[model samples]
Target: MKNKFIKISVCTLALSLLLGSCTDDILDEQSRTVYTPDYFKTEAGVIGGLTGMYAHLRYMYGQAYYYNATLTGTDEATWGQSADGNFKDADLSGVGNLNSSSSRSDVLWNTAFSNINAANGIIENASAVGISEALVSEARFFRAFDYFLLVQTFGGVPLDLGSGELKFNVSQNRTSVRNTVPEVYTKVIFPDLVTAVANLPDAGRVTGGATKTVARLHLAKAYLTYGWWLENPNNIPTYPETPRTDPDGHNAQWYFQKAYDIAIEGIDNPGPFALQPTFYDVNVATNDRNNEILLMADHTESSEIFNGGSLTFGSGGAPDNFAGWMLTWNYTSLVSGTTPAWTAKVSSVQREAAQPYGRPWVRMAPPQGVFNNTFADKVNDSRYDGTFTTVYRGNWDKTTLIGTNPVLYGANGIAVEPGDAIFSFLNEEPSQPIDFSNTTYNSGIGAGVLPGRADFVLPPSRISRRVYPGLWKLGPYRTDNAGGLGQPNAGSTRPFNVAKFSELYLVAAEAAVKGAATQPGKSARDLVNVLRARAGKWRYSNADNAVFIQDNSAAAVAATPAVIDINYILAERSREYFGEGYRWFDLVRTQKWNELAGTYTICGPNLTDVTPQTFTRTIQPFHYLRPIPQGQLDAMDMPDADIEAYQNPGYE
Candidate 1:
């Protein structure tokens, strides 16, 4: 009921469930004394049960927002924002460290278990009292949901399959670890989700909240990813030099097929939500609200779009920072080039420095390479207009939009100087390369810019900044200029930003192509085309295109063809979901990583201290799974990976 942003008015009337609030100052075990079997005997108890789960969500939910964006353990693509930037160029020697406390995995692990406990209480009592089988489905679905997050981030965690049946000494007892990857999947996730799919009403069954179908999405993902099961060598048995033909372990392809089936089933059912009809239908400013794929999390309230408005992933810029940090220079270019091209204010120096703090989604610039390659404009891609743009920040009416004060001031904020060209990103073939005075890069030929040569750009034409074809679409609200929405430091005026949908479409498309289903029973090829066609980048006609073409996994494995490898899926996802915050994860899954620190030094003299491969390795570490939170390692008695090393010792 701590409604800092907007409180749900109907929620108060919907329930008389005011069991009690914890007397403790914060979430601690000592304060949680009111709980008892008799406590959840009424409908109010059900409401209380649900809110108890909701209370623990902010940590994991917020973490997901930011972590999803800067997935780079360390990559050049890292805009050096939030925990992402810190992990990219790992530093423990430094005074203040960023990656440790802010990580969602830590929060996710703890909160998931906490919610699981509440769910345990509900499952034990909900059935006997019999509050609509629907409500029971909700509890089970949510329980599955929490575990699903744990399964992905930490692998097979301590599964508390048993509920509040334990009391007395049980209150002080910690949960016991259980079931291997296969066991958890077969027992907990699989069965619960299957029940949810059947008895839980359709998508919109409980409008304004999660329904049965949403629960199925989690099932689909669990089946698709197959969680820690992928780790079992017995399942994915080690193969010979060439194993594609020999065959061995669990077919990852099968799980993906199941994922596609679940997704399609939900799509067919038209739950409480529907994908935005057009790119224009999406409101980037809000960051993420009312999204079709958004199973949980509320953006209507405060600080949802904490990162870079709509340019970066989940968490943009909420925490404060000092000057001289690289933000969405490339992102500005991409968003500017977008169809309704947003133009940002131009300034030589940031009047305000962006510090990496707050949530994961920060509106930092994309790496230089991304600007040039993947997300850039290619013959007027429909997504180009919606996704990419040049202007990194804008000035707009915030009072009317979200009833908030404006963030930027012309006399105070961005003081544009003479010859400072502000770029607007419109999705047309770029006529000429545009440059910013502050652009920095590593030289191919020789040492270009250096400390010795302070004067980098010889002429105004040779600006430090160069225009790449892509746009930073995540942060629709944030900018150094803070011109949009009127406040001097305001992030965005829009309320909802959709980062998951576009990217998920790509995920679904790729899985569908692996002999899954293009149109239910037909080839999965058309599935690819449907998505590509929507993006305005369908190269082939229906079945003729690379996406629509038949994909023989055997043929794919034989030639290491682009058509069937992880690269195609990754790249396509990058194209579809750029700025949505999955970049780092996508890279890790593919094992293509690099830290940003020294990837772009002025060409000419190579610094012995830093190398391109250093960045590469840093990024690779992220693939090992994000560095495990030190606090978690310290808190747990379990044997852990090298915690001091800032490595993600990996999930159990």
Candidate 2:
């Protein structure tokens, strides 16, 4: 009644009926002020309950819980010193050190359950009020979404489907007993989602809201994860030490076919969906709710939500999207001025507007392994440039002087010449061996020839700690409104994409490799080529036009392994979905968690300095499933035996 932000208690539902009686009186003021389980039986009440659940997601995504839990344990990123061991126990080599007491884990588990519980309320009370099938289906979609994340993270959890009455059963809440991963999927996730798919609106749902196709997209992904969970060829509890074994009754082919069929339906069904012609076009701020995104978590700058766009994580401001802030490079650390002395345009009124660009947290960075190993042709892969900002031309106007004296443009003065190459990130690290004559750096200041020295590339003069390449994909939109002179708390307002239609291509390709059904006139090769061809077109047509950005021809597709193996598909995903928080789940679902984590040399800025030189710890098999948050285990009102039984296998 009072806009559902008012927190309700679980005990309220269980005791609601007991507080009611067969009495009719004007003294029933309690009914107007407080919500009982019976309130959810009404249409307005059901909608309020659903709105509260959605609002919780907005808050949860704004927090560090989801990204911290998912991003660190993968190959793409590592827990840097800035995080101060936030997810370190889980991400580091001493896998056994991670126990049930981790606060971050506690945050993730509790936040998700809040949404799951809210969905249960809607489903249980819908029939009593005769709620529409579509609305109930929306509630089911959210329930399945929460359970999907739970099963993936915790393996098994209490399967609570409110039976007949909204008792909020204390026993169900208190029990630490866990279900099997398969049981959770089959019993809870699959059924609810199937109901969601059958009953949700057929089309034209809002971008951030649940639609039939959105349900189908997740349902397909569930099938894919299920296929791998059964007889996971790569699931060696201890790998290299232990041999890979295909478990009995692993009908992977069956599940892959089911996944392939569903994915193809989503892709081929006549609807408003197609891959954006350019990778940049797909993710830019103007395209926040574009056709490419099947589902995304929406955020706004005006709302008192999280952190602002350009400002780093801890700086005081209203709630803005901190995801971009966390991944952004420490811009303030780069330049040598207290008050920013650089302005690209001479007559600019917002001359000091460039200050916000220096406000990033620089918490995490993309692993160098991806640039070297995954991007076989990063120069031509439109995604590389679309995703990363490799060059930083000086925006400081020449007239600005430093050191309380007149400083000129050249020789130690703080003036940027018109053609200066302020920052450069080579495709290959300088320490690695390479052939000299043909090697060239696309410094955006013409070709940079490799120097004679073997220790590093480009003189050490250009290789300062401040020159690291920041990810541009999640950058704060630099519009006049957003990039105003003193736009306080102006940070990211972009939607965080949860599912994209382009990912379906990769899914379809992987399913095809695993002996599943394929789309008509579309092989795995064709699907990958479509994306590549789009990349090639963008490379040639875009403004950053340099000769190095070549197109992927038919021959390139033929040579590529996307037509043959899973490794290339994983590699392509690394290229496409870098900072979108897709890495951990992608690696886990594919069973490549241990292998890639062991193989790749992930590096980040050192603890005391901004040098991109710290290496990550090797990953272990137990990392396939995140340890149950210690707080959950401590909070559960159960015996030690039940807690022990419920804890995932390797975490103990």
Candidate 3:
């Protein structure tokens, strides 16, 4: 229950100052300057250092560029119309290239090591300071967390930052060595997470604190990922040129079975986490920080200082939760008119500080395949409706454009009001013929018109790199925007969810499909059905803009194939966690990135260019691992050959 933010200084690592305080959330700011070893030996210093671990998440999670690195270039997303090199480079479609410098994965690389050092300092000195083992386990969890991310991203980052392995380095040193992938998992990630799971309490000490279930989730995931590495199903190459053998003398199936057991254990023993009754409830802005979320990078709307970024505006920088804006198209460009011929235009769906109408950067967009295939059963499954902002409603009342006439002319010259649907990305092609010609009402964004509907409609196939359904799950949400457009430009105050309880189901199913032995009533099909059944029960329809209750659990569960394969599990994962930044890792873990995401289809950037164009990614065996960041290599004082050896295989 004791939640206080403290800032501690380490000799080599430049840990940032902590900001703001909320009950249950540990990322509040308070400053103190102290040297590492002695500082962590004190009780205040230990707590302060632990708080730094939570704060470091802000540096990566909500940062838009880093978020783009995780989802873009994968099947779930592509570079949008306004995408710059950061996005285009990741796409791997030849527009630009992903390399050591341009890759936004640097966000993780830069932020994680500093915090890892902080965690190291805490783990070493906490016990001496009389800090509880429970408190120390928090440090242990973070240590493993960073290394897990590092090993997955760069394939063998240094475990010994400057000193001996896992030791708190008290002096600055530049030279570094990359460990083999096997060494990282054995020496750091797996061991620390195992201890963390055993020592951490069922309930978090503070809001958003690490707990047993979270530790179990990561530990299980580590086993699952390591299992895939051992199997090397696709014969993908590894970095540092290490063999895919586990140091612990276990085979891939051993790890797979362990992954399944631990995940099921976590699911059965969920202390304060469980699935939300409906997917809509899980992501609704009002329902932020719900129980379904196991871990998140915490943020707040109350104060600019506490939020770690401006509440009124954001520059799309680190510590700002602006990732949502990247997938958001420029909906404010939509024009409605006063006359039947639609000459006098006004912005009908003005940008607002609400869940659906956040500021748009148009940096990354979903491919048409996401709409047509991944979520083909739009009616039986609520995930498609829950995941995207398909409808852009009129909020002109919130702007000065509402002057005198409360009504505006829309598609088919129908009169529209403030709450009417202005434009919509239809879930499916309408039975009625849609007129795509721009001669009528210039809907501005290449949207078409149906006969009776006032809302301009674009069917599934019409989705483009310029305009597609915005990621509704990650949109901005604010309670302070009273009567007018609030700070839509500001980063979202909502916590960026990092892990969810529902993922345990997917992880277990994936492991089971990989030849792990399943328990009674816990087969791969059974595990997937748990979530599919939940997808059927919908309490609110996002498209209809109303509370329409329906339970299609029978149909949803019945639709599940009797035999579930790895592909089905991957498809289900996309439905559950799309655009939430889980795609790349999921595909990478199962070695399905090239197979699933190699070819994708999307229309051109211009509104009128709705013809789908297929693009191919040149994913090579060496691309399985991202390049070791150029900045890290440049900072080190190693020889040119040593540095060349230090980088991942492809980037050189």
Candidate 4:
């Protein structure tokens, strides 16, 4: 009888039913509220169940541990100084092992199946309740969405979740069987998305809701990924051990062409979505949920109950948008002197609710290659500036540590006010030598003093695991705090953007690069240039903390090679969507994981350890697909050999 605004806990009992024996360990408590098949036949139950589908995204997207699994081992990131087993294991560099127990992909494993079962319940019964086909399509989109994620991560996940294939299950069934890659895609993901695209409305039913455009985007991506799976260019092994052949007898090229066609169609049908004028406008905290973002795991600052997590503090668990914190170094550790002679030290960069500063978990750090190779052209590209928090400005005035002193002594014994730059991560090595030996003026966190600047600086080469440029794109933003830091410890309220309109271009370009026939002006090069040109325009400089207008679209376009390849597309994707959790999937899809991220360079974990060291990852063939979660294996009431067969090869 309640509306969709009811929390996920009250709407569905699928978590317990789907996981069976694992429920006691995974969920806090078995949900007392159970929706019968008959319950879903009612209008209230159908609406509330649909709401649960949208609400499930929080359990995976913004949760920091899962975020680490997606990017930490890739070329984009590595484990940070404060990393525990969760972060270190994901790096695959011998610090820890990525077993079924340790893999953070469990975040998806634990959350998605329950949501899929819930979606099945809604899709089956909502039609009986006279729900509009458009409304039911939302459930279809989510079902397909989860399957797409599962097939990519675990190589052949169970589509039959205690029910018949894609059917709603009322009773708990512990035994499970894995489906083949082609079976999962052909039977579940592709069909549901195709139906969703046909029946769904042009505009989203609600804010951040599934729509025709979003469904098309996922379908195109699904095609692209499956095409890669079929090609298996690197001869990577797959679970369930099925041959790389489409059930429909379509070749890899057929899927690639379909992917390109659908992505371009989605781009043409711009319903309430378009690229932001400049790339900077797309990610600036104030501009979140803008037209460019097609879908996101929605969060709110208005109500703690509805937000699904605490507004003032976060536990860094599921349903909390804390992914931003992992890439954020402990900027609060940066110290400044209260007097000009550098007598007493104070925390200059206090944690704040503003865009650049948030609670620091320090679980992940970017490698030096991110600066030296990926974002090498720091001059014309606005993305490098928009993506990283290079400048740590003074906010000691907000803290009692500065007391009566209005200014703090920064680099070279220069005075800096409340808003002045206290420390900076230089885009390139300075012409004037940085004095790392000046222990008196050097920031304790591996920062060195430049001659004239008030801010201590770290060149790209000196960036270490303990201190690197924080991810500015995904940082916290809050308006509730008037003067003081407002809940700096709370998870970010900004919607963790899952899909963007700009990505449509990247997807289409990738498909074209993989031998898809190109349209007249829509070749791989043209599609990539669309994003590169946007990267050249800048309205504001995040590093300078001031208005900066520049348009080098000509230069950016000119820089693109005459014939672009998959490696170039990957590089462009990194430049465009860096630190937003796309790296691992990108590398895995192209089978370039070991090739691109085999060895990475970064300074050691300690503050004074500035010399770069290269680390190697043992990226065996089996590492392409993450291991199935141990909890899932433990829940299955199957024979030992059957269970062993169910797990991915190396993880067992």
* Per-residue alpha-carbon lDDT of candidate 1 for residues 1-652, written as tens digits (9 for 90 to 100): 2322221100111001111233211111223334455656666666566655443443344343344334433322443323343433332113123354545445455556555655666666786777777766676777777766655554445454232221111233322333344555665677778877777775433222446556666676676656224423222221111122212245666676777777677656655556664443353343245555444333331343222123323223322111112233322211111111212322222222121111222323344445444544444344544454332232222223322323321211232221122222333323453232233332211112323221111111111222222232333234432432223233332332222334345555555654465564323344444455555522222111123222223332232233544455665666665544455444433334332222432111122212222122322232234334555445433334323322333222
Q: Report lDDT (Cα) of residue 605, candidate 1.
A: 14
Residue 244 of model 3: what lDDT? Answer: 85
> What is candidate 4's TM-score against the reference?
0.96
Q: Model 3 TM-score?
A: 0.96
**Winner by lDDT between candidate 3 and candidate 1:** 3
lDDT (10s digit) by residue, model 3, range 463-530:
99988998899989998988889889888988899889898998999999999999999999999999
Count of backbone clashes, every candidate in sequence: 106, 12, 6, 0
The Cα RMSD in angstroms, rounded to one decimal, for candidate 2 relative to the true structure is 8.0
- Model 4 gets an lDDT of 0.87
Ranking by TM-score: 4, 3, 2, 1
TM-score of each: 0.62, 0.77, 0.96, 0.96
Model 2 lDDT at residue 47: 71
Give the clashing pairs for model 4.
Answer: none
State each model's CA lDDT, in order: 0.40, 0.55, 0.86, 0.87
- The predictions' CA RMSDs to the true structure, in order, are 11.3, 8.0, 3.1, 2.8
Best by lDDT: 4
